[model samples]
Target: MPSRARLKPRKMPTQQRSKATVEAILAAAAQVFRRHGYAATTTDRIAQRAGVSVGSLYQYFPNKDAILVTLAERHIDAGFALVRLLLREALAETPPLAAMLRRFVLAMIVLHEHEPELHRVLFEEAPLPSHVRRRLRERENELASEVSRLLEAHPEACVRSPDVTAYVIVHTVDSLVHSFVLHPPKDIDADMMTNEAVRMLLRHLTAEGS
Candidate 1:
């Protein structure tokens, strides 16, 4: 018998289609994970929600955790991007430092209010795996660097070093927002809390290099 002829497999889609598939899967996974946390979310469910087969899901994500990590990356990147845009816009408007800080605080508060559920998922529900945490740390460092650059533009400020000051300011604001969402103080009015936080942030940043 003559040797059987072999047919080469068709070439896979270009990188663009692969990216679109990954994005679609991540988006669907986010919806499912949001509705039903990590423990309850399943690969099959993600595939179904994504309008793709299990095999296709695996092509991009080995398992559910991979999808969660992707979502976390996207969310954190988005959050930081929003901060960058807000700061840039405020800078363009040449707002006073105190006013800019107030706007920053309000921006975070509004973000929390705008997507409470997603914020909860990001802050409360989803556990930041080691890899995700590492990425977040890098983002934090970048944010600090950006803040330092921003502060350098304000050379008249009393603060001597922008790097350290930026880190402190970013972390302080993060702590305040996290605390507000987790446990609001009873004695302080919500509006007053935001106001006080903004004031404290400005005072701390502007205080004579103690």
Candidate 2:
């Protein structure tokens, strides 16, 4: 088997047409990989689904893992956008921290719900390259840094250690949201799960000098 180091995309798109083709290929790859499973999916299948020739697919992605990595990056980028938006507007709002946390949690749920099947394949099933895995960690850290800064600025934040608290909050919210939303228990309501998540974080952060 080929090593993971060879999995990165051959080159980034620089022109309008190239960008469109890359987008189409990634969009089709999400569908193909989700429907067929990662191990069974092939570049030809993705090319056919994208309505582009096999040559065109190879022009951007060197292999199936490259396509998978790009899809993962796109998905993570959307989540990053949500994080930026919350940091931009939500933190400035006068709402309590619980309300803000609820908003963040709900936004994540919406992202997962938008394409649950594809998300499962990319995040849980696909054989992600090392860089792809590292990218995911970097994104988490980026968001954590932003959240830590926000906590420091907020008067209500009682945690003496903003960075540590931010890391815990990011991973906690991410793991619980993915688990309960994707493979939800038969008995618990989704909204209730989300609300409970918000409450859980609020209690930890709001206590005196927590």
Which candidate number would show the highest TM-score if scored against the true structure?
A: 2
Count of backbone clashes for each model? Answer: 0, 0
What TM-score does each of the candidates earn?
0.77, 0.88
Give the per-residue lDDT digits (tens) of candidate 1, residues 1-210: 111111111133369978787778877887887788767889899899989999987765666766666677777788777877777787677667777777777766664554455556766776656656787789878777767776666644468778988888878777778678656777876589878887787777777566
Error of 1 at 35 (Å): 1.5
lDDT tens digits, residues 1-210, model 2?
246656777888999999999989988988898899888899999999999999988888788887777788888788777766776576677467777778778866776776788888888888776777888899889888877877776778799889999999888888988998779999899788987888788888888485
User: lDDT for every model?
Assistant: 0.71, 0.82
In model 1, the clashing pairs are none
Candidate maximizing lDDT: 2
* Local error of candidate 1 at residue 27 (angstroms): 1.8
Task: Write down the lDDT that model 1 would get.
Answer: 0.71
